[model samples]
Structure formats: C-alpha cells, structure tokens
Target chain A: MVRQKVLLIKVGELKDLFRKLFVVILFLTAFLFIMLSRFDSVAIEALNKVVIKVTGPVMQVVELPARVIHHVWTYFYDISHIYAENQLLRDENKQMMILQNKVRTLEVENQLLSRLLNYVPPAEASFMSAQVVAESGDKFTHLLLIYVGNEAVKKGQIVMGDESVIGRIDTVSPPYAKVILITDINSKIPVVVERTRVRGILSGNNKDLPQLIFMRSTTDVQEGDIVVTSGVGGMFPAGLPIGFIGSINGNRVEVEPMADLSRVEYVRIVDYGLAPDAELSVDFVESEQNAR
Target chain B: MRDNWRENLKLFAVHRIPLIATLMMVFLFFMPINSVQINYFRPVVGIICVYYWSLTRGYIFGFFSAFLVGLIIDIYSSLPVGVNVMIMMLLVWTTDWLRKYFSMSSFGVNWLAFAIICTAFLLLKWAFLSLYFHHLLPLAGSGLGLLSTVMFYPLIAYINALIARKFLPQERIDE
Candidate 1:
C-alpha cells in the first residue's frame, strides 16, 4: 500500500510521466550505445555515418553565405585582375621558367648522387581532385569538408593542393572527408628546409601561417627557402613541398604555405608509409660500397 | 487538433513577419560582401533558433536538434567533425538546466543565464582548440573577437525573444 502510494505521488508531478521516463530511458540507451563499443568498430562507424547523414543538409544551409561570398569573389577577380595581372603574371612566368630550369637540373644531380649513394628515393604521392562541400568552424577549430574523390583517401593521409602541402585527412565517410587545415594550432609536422636542409620542428600558429620552432640558432635556413616534409618521423613522405619560409629570426622561422588554402578545390593524397627496415638503411653507405 | 491548427496559423503569421524581416536583413548584409572583411557570424541565427525551440518544447528539441544546429554552425564556419556539435550539446543542456529557475517569463534573469552559457561556450571552444593544437592561438586578436560576440548576444537574444513571444506559445494572462 505504501509503495503504491509513493509511485502514484511521484508520477503525478511529471506530466505524461511514463512517456517522459521512457524518453529519458531511450536517451540513456543511446548514450550507452555510443560508449559501449569494445573494438566494435562497425557499430561506431554506422553511428558516425548516421550522424553525418543527418547533419549533412544542415551544414549545407550554414555554408550558403560562404558560397555566395566565393561566387561574388570570382566576379571581382575576373574584373579587377584580367588585364594588368596578365602582364605581371607573364613577367613572373618568365622568371619562374628560368628558376624552374635551374631547379630541374639540381633535381637530376641530386637523384644521381642519391642513386650513387644507394639512398632510397622519396615515395611518389598520388593526387585526388575534390570539391569543397562546406566550410565550418568556430573561433578555435576550423575544418573543411571535401567531397570524396575516386581515389580512396584515409585518415592521417597528407592532402596537397597546387603541388604544395595543404593538410591531412582528419576523418572519412564514403563520399566525404573532413580536412583539418595546417593553420590550426593543433597541427604539427617534422620539416626540413629544402635550400639549407636544416631539420627542425614545424607547427601551426592558428594564424595565417605556421612557425618553425626550436631550431638551432646556427641552423642553415633562410627566407625564401622551401619547407618540405623531413620524413624523419614517418608522418609524411619526404620531398612533399609544404610551404616557403616568409620570415626567419635567430632560431625561429615563419612560413607562408604554397597552397592557397582559401581556394583549394582539389588535393592529392599519396599512399605513403614508413619503409621497412628504414633504420637499417640509415646511411646506405655499406649498400653503395657493395654496389661499387 | 482543430484549436492547435488555429493557434499554429496565428503563430505562423506572427512569426513569419519577423523571420522575413530578419532574412531580409541577412540577405542585404550578405549581398554586398565583396572584398570587405566584415565580421558577420552566421551561426548565431541557428543557435538562437535552437534555444527558442528548446525552451518552448524541450522534449521535442532533444539531442538531435542541438546536434543539427551545431552541424549547421560547422557547415557555415568550416570546422572539422562538427566540433560545434559538442559545444551546442553543452549549451542546450545548460540552458535546459537554468530554465528550471528562469523561463522566458523571467525576462532579464533568463537572458543573464543565457549570456553566461554563451560566454562559457566560447571559452570552452577556445580551450578545446588549444588543447587539440597544444598551444594558445593568439587570443588577443581572437579573444577580442570573442568579447564582441558577447556584444551581439544581447541583441540576438532580444530579437529571438521577440520572435518567440510572437510564435509557439506565450505566457498567458488568462492561464
């Protein structure tokens, strides 16, 4: 009798109490479902897919203004830079061609020496072109959704645009992948200067550029030097052009990336990983001498 | 159902006018954005709307609505993995909590609670991004922008409350 009376009293305060209690139960169930994955990757994946699908349209709605801005931006570019910029570009191209020849010649020499020294060449990266589906971020974390390409790109894969490194894949759905840009404060990479071959740490500053920190003051790096993946830690492939140093201080350097991140429409994600027995082939001196 | 339809129609007419007015304001604000680096935050509209729905119909606007709103914010802003989802979930939950003491009828008290939640949210987002990136992202530039977000909050809350009072259900003198 007392138990019945307590139940009746408790039930009276909550309107549609049983139904609300059921909803609360269902919500707890969903929370448990999310947390209870024990190497049960498939369920987690399906849940992520459901979340992505439900969220997709909403994201598109949010992107309307940015899309409009981009379209309007094109009109300004066409009108403003059509004539005068062509002449400027022509001059720039001529100088670039001259520099390009020198670079090609150096590359050939470097390749020959590497072969002579029995050093393994950098892995070739594959490019996948994609369209920007959306741009979403708050004050802290900014990310972009790229429509998945025909070529499969996975999480942690390096993504490049304009032959310069942009960032890497963060997550993937079947037809879309989220890319975390290098400018996020969380981004880090081991990089080496192409001009001076000075190896150091490269990390983003959450600004328009990233900074190379903790380099030896005597490090042989300079402004205008190209920064590429050192491949020292195996996060990225060597020889991938990431950015160019825009400023250099005593032990710190700032880089403006080669990829125009704002207008990145396509990117390449090369299938690259650490080589087997990379440590054993450290100098490759024994292999070279044996070959000789 | 019949009375509800009548109520909905009246609600729709009342709500439609301000919504259109707001949309017109947004359209005009967006139309001329060529080279100007204007600091218009698009995500605020959807957030304010979600808060409205959550307060009016908490049961109806559960996790999914909050999730959808966050995703929309992410889409407009270009964040990875809908990080706004996490933030919005917290915001919705907190507002729901504070609604116990302060509902829409409570006026300034409710708005004050909402302001604290929004501020806490901005700080939380900053904290998450910093923790993820492993460093502060130069907050003086970004931090000032955060404070400015507070300035817009009261205006956004006021506009949203005015719209909400017109639609859904208002506190009735007859009740």
Candidate 2:
C-alpha cells in the first residue's frame, strides 16, 4: 500500500512537471517559427507546401456542398436574367463585329509601323487555368488557395481574371498554390497610367481598392485613367490590364480593379519567361497574321 | 471481454463527437465560398466548441489536444505556424480554469463570461497579428465578427445541449 501510494505521488508530480515543460516547449517552438518566417526560411516554405498538399483535397471535399449551392443559386439567378442578357449579347455581338474589323486594321497598321520602326513586342504569356480551392480564414489578410502546385507552377507567376491582372502566386506546393490578391497589404505591383504613361507602385492596404503610390508629383495622373502592368520587375508581363483610377486623395490614388475579385471562380496562371531585367524586344513579338 | 470492449466503444463515441464536430467546423471555415468581406467576419467556432464542451459536459480539453487542434487550424487558415497554436492554448487554458465558476453560474451569467472572453480573444488576436506583422491591422471587420460570434453563442449552445442530451450520459451533465 505504501509503495503504491509513493508511486502515485511520483506520477502526479511528473505530470505537473510535464505540463509545465510542455507549455514552455510549445511556446518556444511557436516563437521560433515566427522569427524564422521573418528570414523566409526554405524549410518553412516546404512545410507550408506539405501542409497545403495534404489539406487541399480535404478542403475541396468540404467546399463541394457550398460550391454546389452557390452554382444552384447562380443558375436560378441567371435564368431570371437570361432573356435580357441574351438580347444584350445580341446587340453587343453586332457592335463587336464592327470593333473586330477596326481592330484588324489597327493590328495591320501597328505591325507595319512596328516593322518600320524595328520595335520589339513582348512575348505573349501562356496560361494554365486553375480553380480556386480554398481560402485563408483570417480577417486581416487576403489570400486564396488554388488547386495547382509548384510542380507545374512557380511562385511570382501572374494570376489573371479574364484580361485583368488580379494577383500573383505567392507560394506553391505539390497539389496547391496560394495567390496573394492585389488588395492584400503585402502586394506591390509596378503599374503605369496607360494614358499619361506615368509610372507608380500599386500598393494594397487590405481594402477593395489598392492605392497607386510613389508617383512623381509632376506626373500627370488623372482620375478614370486606365492602369496596366509596367513590366518593371519582369514578374508580370507588360500591358496586362490592372485597374482604373477610382479616387485621388491628395497624393494617394485608389485603383478599382476591373476583375470582380469576390466573384472570380477560376484564375489563369501565366508565365512570362523573360529575364528579370529583360526589356521588350522584336524577337519576343509574334504576329498571328504572319503565323497564319 | 466483449462487454468491456463495447462499453469502451460507447464511451469513445460519446466523447469523440464534440471534437469531431469542432474539426468539421474548422473545415467549413476553410471552404472557398466566403467572400473576402464575409471571410473577415467568421466566428471563432473552435472557441465555441471548447467553451460548450468544457461548460456542460465537463470535458476539459488538455493543453496538448488544444495545441494539436490549433496547429490544424493554423495549417487550414494559412497562418504563421504557431499563431493559432498560442491562441488555442490560451482559450483552452482559460476555459479550463473557469470551468468551475461556469458550472455554478446561471446560463446568462456563463454567456456573459463567454462574451467577455471572446472579446478578449479577438483583441489578443489583433494585437498578436499587429505585433507579428509590425503594422496596424484594421479592426472594424474583426469588431463586426465579434458581434456576430457573440450573437451566435445561444444557437451554438442550444445545438451543443441537444448533442449532449442525445449522445452523452447523464453522469457527465450532473458532474
């Protein structure tokens, strides 16, 4: 009885010690990760990929029901507007044919002009489409997890919605990738006002509209000006549409992205295989008419 | 031996449901359907689960289990590895520490305590993120989220009670 009592007391004491030790170890590990992340450790990045690869399928399964519900809801909503939308489409199609003719003539004229000037066009980026699989649940940051990985995709590839640049892939793993939206606080894109040709940095503040920053005071930036990628960093291709100037607050200019980020169902990941400092050259240009 | 095994399996079934349910809620939060605005307003479902189980069923989630769960949440949320780990540990410890008072208090009183704790949790999370990122994160969305989470407590509590009544033994409630 005495030996049993002694053993029980020892076990209780050990449990208490273990609990205290566990707390210290757990907190230390967490803090270590926080510090290591500041340095952008490769191991941490690898771990992130592993976690995503394992969890991506689980997330897809969980999201299936909600996606179905959304589709059904959208189906009903679209059916209600189908007749009106079809009429609008018909009218738009007539206008589009006329616009297509104008574009064709412009394209030929531009090709001749570029040939005369010996101007080099940029390489057109090819894209692999991926469906958005999951999302970060945090209220502070804007991130999307998509169903494509580093195996076929790389970080810094431009993510697009139709014709507009929406975000870039931040990280990739085997079966999943994370896209940091232009509205994330961490996002910064080199952009230019298409009309004025003035360059500025597109910065996100976790708002729906990202701000254009670092423009020279003398730069002629106007409200309602279209913004496109400047291709300064070579991470994104030149002339990819970004957004339009929304409102100017003193030096601050907010840009409203043309892509409806909230409604984006799938994104195109594009690779522009230019060197980081490579400038646009004639060798990069491909003419569809010449190819034909 | 068969009777003993059957009893053990029954006990596991009753005890495991809350943990499983909490995990399912985490998965639901990870789904892509939420808009960016709505994503910011997600209720801390893990806390609600922990609070409910600890209060009614006398199941005090141990520190390690809480840590593991937090890690899963961190992985799911794409947070810095340890952020949710620390937050979840704090939640479990606080809930465990206050379990005694909760048992003695009226439902309204217990809920008021939850309100206070949830508010503190949100504040702690905000402060941690600000410190981690070295920037002032906007608080308006999280404030709205807190309101919704608080508002959701009763419904979640009712659901928890139903589960407890249906699956759990009377001894757990009495204790």
Candidate 3:
C-alpha cells in the first residue's frame, strides 16, 4: 500500500513538471514566432501559404450564410427604392450621353497628338477578376482575402474596383491571395496630380482618407485635384485612378480614394510589367548612340 | 462489462462539448455583420469560449486545445502567427489559476471578472502589436473592442450556458 501511494505521488510530480515545461515552451515558441515573422522569415511564408491554401475554401464555405443574408437584405433594399432609382438613372443617362460624346472627341484629339509626338503607349494589361472572400481585421489593419490563388495572381499586381485603384496583392497562397488595402497603415503608392502633374507619395494612415506627402511647397495642388498612379516605381501602371484630394491640413493633404473599400465586393487584378525608369534608361542609351 | 462500455461511450459523447464550443465560437467570430462600426466593435467571442471551458471543464480543456484554437484564429484573421496562440494559452493559464480561488456559482462575479479580463486582453494585444510593428498605434480601436467585448459578454455567456446545459449537463452538476 505504501509503494502504491509513493508511485502515485511520483506520477503527480512528473505531470506537474511536464505542465510547467509545456507552458515555458509555448511562451518561447510564441515570442520566437513573432520575432521571426517581423523580419519575414522564409519558413513562416511557406507555412502561411499552406495555412491559407487550406483555409481559403473553408472560409468561403463558412461565410456563405452571412453573404447570403447580406445579399437578401440588399435585394430587398434595392427593390424598395427601384422606382426612384430608375427615375434617377434616366436623368443620369441623359447627362452621361452628352459627357460621353465630349470625352470621345477629346480622346481622338489626344491620340492624334500622341501619335505625332512618337509617344508609344504602355502595353495593355489583361485583368483577372476575383471575388473578395473575407476581411480579416478591424480598425487597425485592413486586409481582404480574395478567392484567386497564386496560380493566376502574382504579388505586387494592382487591384482595382470600378476602374479605380484599391490596393495591391501583398501575398498569395494557393487558392487565395491577400490584398492590402490602400488605407492600410503599411500601404504606400506613388501618385501624381492630374491637373498639375505634381508627384507625391500617398501614404496610408489607417484611416478612410490616406495622407499625401512630399508635395512641393510651391505646387499647384488644390483640394479637389484628382490623383493617379505615376508609374514611377514600375510596380503599378500609370493612369489608374487612385483618389482625389479631400482636405489640406497645413502641408498634410488627405486623399479620399475613388474605390470605396468598405463596399468592395469584386476586384480586377492587372499586372503592369516593370517601372518607367527602365524605359527612360533605354531611351537615354539610344539617344547617345545617335549622337555618337 | 457491457455497462462499463456504454458508460465510456456516454462519457466520450459528453466530453466533445468543449471542442464543439470552441469551434462554434470561431464560426461566430467570422460571421460578417456588414457595418463598419459593428465590424470595428467585433467581439472576441472565442475568448469567452476559452474562459467558459477553462472555468467549467478544465479537465478536458487544456493548454494545447487553447493553442490550437488560437492558431486557427490567427490564420483566419491574418494576425501574425503565434500572437493569438500566446494570448489564448495565457487565457487558459490565468483562468485555470483564478478558477481555483473563484467558484463558478456566482454569475455576477464571473461576469465582472470577464470584463476585467477582456479589458486586460485588449490592452495586452495593443501593446504586443505596437511592439511588433515598432510604432505607437492609437488605443481608440482597443477601447472600442473592449467596450464591445464587455457588452457582448452576457449574451455570449447565456448562449454558452445553454450549450453546457444541453450537451454537458452531467458535467456541470459535478461542481
């Protein structure tokens, strides 16, 4: 009886030791993981790929009920206002038709001017359409998971909603890719003022309106000037509509993005190959050879 | 011998409640409510599950289960790997420790304790992320998150109580 009692005590002590050891290991593991991921280790990337690939489809299935409910509510809301909306559309169509004709005439003239100047337009990029699956964060981080995987999608490709730039593909796993919204704290885009061609850096402040930085103090930028990608980095193509200047607080200008991030349901991803700097260097070499 | 086998089966069936509860909470976490304000105020429903199971059924719910649930949340929410893992494990440990001193019979006390725990959790999360990102993120979101978590605590607790009564009724009475 004494031996049995001693054996039980020994087992209990061993269990207690194991539990303490396990907790220590967990703490170490978590700390090490956060540190490794902050530096963006390769192992973590591979593991993220595996996790996202498996979870992508499962999350879509899990979110179906919520999506269905949202769609139903939208349908009812749309039906309730269809008559008024139809009347508004009729008025909009008449205005748009007049604007369309004016735009077409200007486009023809601009094409002629460009042809005469020997300006070769950038190659047209093909777009792959994807449905946004789910959003993963709250106020601090804005990330969206799209249904397309790495097979058809590449990192750094621009994602657009309704012909306006929304974000870029930051990471992709098989069967899923994450789009980092332009309003995310980490996002930065090179943009230019449409009216003055003044270049500036559009930096996200984790708010609805991202801040425009590095504009020249003597620049002709105004509160309502349209901003478009400058294609300076070769990462994104030039001429994609980004947003408009919303407010100017001192030298800090805010941009209200053309794409409504909160209401984004689908997006088009376009791969614009290489930055404009590469073309500039090529043109410089050709001009030097002609001079020689 | 047959009676013993049946009893074991029954025990196995009843013991799955904790795991089911964890999964149900995860499902609730991902259910999008479509309003930005509501989304910002998204409750940490999984934390409630972790606390509830740790307090009521600590025997079956352990650190590893918490770790697994946390890992899943991290992946689903695109949070850095191991962020949620560490937090959930800490929750299990703290709740396990507190359960020793605090009895589950008083609902009011448990609810108040949860409010405190949830507030601490949001502050800890803010600190950890700020340290990781090497920037000072504003605490507005954290405050809203805490408020939402506290507001949703009663409803989540009620649902969990219902789940416990229906599935793990035999286990709850043992306390």
Clashes of each: 15, 2, 1
- lDDT per residue for candidate 2 within A74-137, as digits (tens), equals 8999999999999999999999999999999999999999999999987776779998876666
Two-chain DockQ for model 3: 0.44
Model 1 C-alpha lDDT per residue in residues B43-135, reported as the tens digit of each score: 344445455556645654555556655544444344433456666666667767766766647656655655666567767777765664456
Chain B TM-score of model 3, please?
A: 0.87
Query: DockQ for the candidate 2 complex?
Result: 0.52
Q: lDDT (0-100) at residue B125 of candidate 1?
A: 72
Flag regions of model 1 displaced more than 4 Å: A1-49, A61-69, A96-124, A205-208, A211-225, A244-256, A260-292, B1-47, B56-59, B62-64, B67-90, B97-114, B125-138, B141-148, B151-175
Identify the candidate with maximal DockQ.
2
* Candidate closer to the true structure by lDDT (higher is better), 1 or 3: 3
lDDT of 1 by residue, A125-217 (tens): 555677667543344544567777445676777777778778777667756677777776546766788877886666767676788865545
True contacts kept of each: 0.20, 0.55, 0.34
Chain A TM-score of each candidate structure, as shown: 0.66, 0.89, 0.86
In terms of DockQ, which candidate is stronger, 1 or 2? 2
Off by over 4 Å in 2: A149-151, A275-292, B1-16, B34-40, B54-60, B162-175
Whole-model lDDT per candidate? 0.60, 0.76, 0.77
Error of 2 at B62 (Å): 2.7
